[model samples]
Target: MADDPILRLRGVHTHIGPYHILHGVDLDVPRGGVTMLLGRNGAGKTTTLRTIMGLWRAGQGSVHFDGRDITRLATPAIAQAGIAYVPENMSVFSDLTVAENMRLAARSGAIDEQRLDWVFRMFPALKIFWHQRAGVLSGGQKQMLSVARAIIEPRQLLIVDEPTKGLAPSIIQNMISVFCELKQTAVSILLVEQNFHMARSVGDTVAVMDDGRVVHAGTMADLAGDEALQQRLLGLSLAAHQ
Candidate 1:
């Protein structure tokens, strides 16, 4: 239902060794829309994504996805539940060809031709470099390959961290176009991004975290229109960031 959240985190706390990261993070990712997670550096944004992927175990609270509790589930099990994660590093196998890296990401051990065609439509560079080694591709092409791998199989949720971190302006624009197209597919996206332009353009919902807690949550339009709120929560206006 549109009223129900696809993913929910309630009073979630996470610890990395002795250092506590997420302090009672209460968040909701609505079904079939992009929910952009924004905050200043060290605001626990990345940790939050890691926690959701089971890279960091939540010390307290619950993570609910598709109406099931997944707080303590193993990483592979959590992934099996239909959540695909694309970390900041764009973890593509450098030594392998783009096709090989994509083939590995398929849980079924075989690529779906129709899905592959769809992905190519989103990122033509991947199709152009199908047989090329990942290490030889430029930064933007590598990022596209990484995303291609994630979407090679059907997924209910896609979580990405700083996908535009080091890309050039043109590449960022391409990514924006691709994400806009992905949004039309109706797959929920929990994106951790510092690029305010990308966030404003693609985010349907916005959540601002500060000091390990969600300090603000609302429609992206609301946040985008309020320069004062943006400054207070993010320490700068989106316009300034852009």
Candidate 2:
């Protein structure tokens, strides 16, 4: 392992009821790069993200960030440590104005004018709807707000789960651009996505999960070269481009 991996998980495991999810998962998220967790629908990708966020505590292994062991920290404590999570549902406050919603997101000395400017630059549509209520915004707009609000502070690492899920092609394109631009700020991103095209487009490293375990880990280029492995581990029905 490197001297300072932004985030690392070793032998992580989780369960719901009697069903165990993660089976001694190990991952190293490099600083200022995108690492995508790829797998089929039931492959425990979401469970891995949840464990990192403290929403699902692993019974074993350790989750470390910036050389500190955070596997036992509470969710709020983890969030205050500069980790932010953007779930797939895009849960924005429906009654609040966009500015109001963004203000609320700015927590523990997080929200600032510079952050606002960066978010607005990524999604000009958010600027247009600054005064509107969140409930009325389209799905794409809501997703933008959900992500932008989280970034209102200096999030050392951002975890987004299935961001492009159920979105229209146009909206998906827009989201890809937003995420790509965000990398310019040098924020490490741990992305959980099933969409092969989107993952390959933004991910620097790719890990394939199956049956609650990480079976393959490598750079995006390496994953692209292994067609049989992609099909077997990820069930990728089509060819993936680098």
Candidate 3:
């Protein structure tokens, strides 16, 4: 692993039954920054994030966090090792109040109060809706709660999948700001996003995945400077955002 690379995956091959999804996926999430994973739907972006989180076993290859091999670790063990995963759906407890959900995520006193304070500061909306059931909150609110839960404990790495999906543009902007702030902390972020404009806004480094392989990677500036590369890989043009 490279020095200070918080998360790294090398030639990872993960298969679900007879269907192989991740084929030689290589990725790196550096410390104290956000690395965006961009791809078209069915490009295995979510699956790659899942594999990194150890939600499923990788048939071949190694996953490293803080310079330790974690490929064979169980999902709960991976989580206990200071990696947190916030899925595309923002998995909130629908039946539980916002406060209840947060308390439950603390893992019976394993979480840090200072971390919770930071998350609440980042998302004052969550503090405001503390008594409401997660099911009753709006989509953007749920996203905030999901993020809050992830930060309930002081984690070294954070993985977020499609966090902007179904959110209003205003909410997306707020989320982008939160990500920017999170990058200032020690926690590294690996994000899977189909939203190009948002990805461009927050991605320090980018890896474009297609057909379960990382086809392109570099600094965000590299991706932004090449219009042809952007158009070809993502079917996106910055003109559309203007």
TM-score for all models, in order of appearance? 0.97, 0.94, 0.94
The digit string of per-residue lDDT tens for model 1 on 94-166 reads 9999999999999988999999999998899989989999999998898998888888998999999998999
In model 2, which residue pairs have backbone atoms overlapping below 3 Å? none
Residue-level error in angstroms, candidate 1, position 101: 0.6
Task: Please give, for residues 186-216, the per-residue lDDT of candidate 3 as tens digits.
Answer: 8889988767777888889989998989998
The predictions' CA RMSDs to the true structure, in order, are 1.2, 1.9, 1.8
lDDT of 2: 0.85
How far does residue 107 in candidate 3 sit from its true spot (Å)?
3.3
What lDDT score belongs to each candidate, Candidate 1 first? 0.92, 0.85, 0.87
Query: Model 2 — TM-score against the truth?
Result: 0.94
The per-residue C-alpha lDDT of model 1 at residue 234 equals 88
Query: Residue 9 in candidate 3 has what lDDT?
Result: 87
Better of 2 and 3 by lDDT: 3
Residue pairs with colliding backbones in model 1 are none
Task: Point out where model 1 deviates above 4 Å.
Answer: none
Which runs of model 2 end up more than 4 angstroms from their true locations?
A: 1-3, 108-110, 237-242
